[model samples]
Target: MKKLELTAQAEDLMKSHSLQGFPNEICGFFYGKTVEGVKHVTVIKPVVNAKEGDQRRRFAIDPLDYMKAEQFVIAEGLEFLGIYHTHPLHPAIPSEHDLKQALPSFSYIILSVQPEKVVDITSWTLNDDRAFEQEEIISNRNVNTSANKAS
Candidate 1:
């Protein structure tokens, strides 16, 4: 597993989506360079909420969305890093269900929009033990493109 790096715009997109999801989990795909020690997130594409639960904002990407994301990455010459989702009113960690579904190689970024007043974002790696271990996500504002990075 590796520590994921979010471009400023990517981070901003995640944060903004989290706010929109408010009481739910905002799910999406992250594309860029996937490697050990350093993972770069160049793009963020939001996915639809498909889970059965209504209380949680976390969304399970639609199958079409997954296919679209994969196609988009290839079209843009980018690598598929992994998926991101928000944990409303909870810690930026994966739940039991999340662990069961996640792959060890992908970077899972969880935004904890909890405590009501403040929102905190964090990243993690799902170890072989199926536990989510915290990882650091450094944001770089130097790169600019069509993606919105403003906070």
Candidate 2:
């Protein structure tokens, strides 16, 4: 099984973002690198949810935001691993709209937020058949610290 590794800080940031967004969905980009075949999230850049209305059930990343995030990733010397979004009151599963918008070779992290808390977090990737497959999440506080020390 492929693994998506996240530093404790990254997880905390996502949780905080989700909670802050509350009844509205929040979206962002995940910046990281793949080490030994494991995708390690080093940074998460939260962006405004550009969906015009009824944001409680959906979220969108503005094209300008996407471009800026890409540039930021390059400037920081990190890869644009994928996207992360909150599912206000929904489960941490991709929706039909997500399926249609997903791009191959990118990881998608979904967080289920209820009221003022995040209930779950899950990572996913599209397979050959264009179906979503869950990726294993490995949250470790030491991973990023050790990697930075090696640098």
Candidate 3:
């Protein structure tokens, strides 16, 4: 299992978005640098959920958003680590929909939000067997300065 290093500021930003979008899933992108084999998520870039169905149980992001994130990260000298989304009433576990949509080399961070509060956060990565493997989340209070500086 790999480690998902989430900065304190990033955590707060995600939780806030989750709370604001209560009863519906909120999704976004994250960028960072890998240090010591850990996926350090630095910036939480919020974007509109472009799913075509009910958002309470489903969340989707457009491919263009990924390109934008990649470009921003490259311009800022960081890697496109992965993306994040909120599960309003579910655990911080990936669903079948998520597993099916997931790709390689990206960390998927899921936040469990109950009512208007964020209850938990977990990260996952697809393994060789195509199974979702839960990755340990490290709440990093002091990530690199670039993360702090990025909006």
Best by TM-score: 2
How do the predictions measure up, each by TM-score?
0.84, 0.92, 0.91
* Model 2 agreement with the true structure over 1-151: per-residue lDDT tens digits: 7899999988888898889889888888888899998998987788888899899988888898898878877897888899999888889999999999999989999999998789999999999999999999998888552122100
Reference-based TM-score, model 3: 0.91
lDDT of 3 by residue, 1-151 (tens): 7998887888888888888888888888888789999887777788888889789988888889777888888798988888889989899989998998899888899999999689889999889888988999988887652333222
Model 1, position 4, has a per-residue lDDT of: 69
Candidate 3 runs further than 4 Å off: 144-151
Best by lDDT: 2
Alpha carbon deviation, residue 28, candidate 2 (Å): 0.4
Model 2 lowest lDDT segment of ten: 142-151
**lDDT, model 2, position 6:** 92
Candidate 1 residue-wise lDDT, 1-151, digit = tens? 3466777788877778777877877787788876566887887877767777784744676687788777878898888888888888887767887887888778788888853432677777777887788777777888652353322
Per-model clash counts, in order, read 4, 0, 0
**What TM-score does candidate 1 get on C-alpha atoms?**
0.84
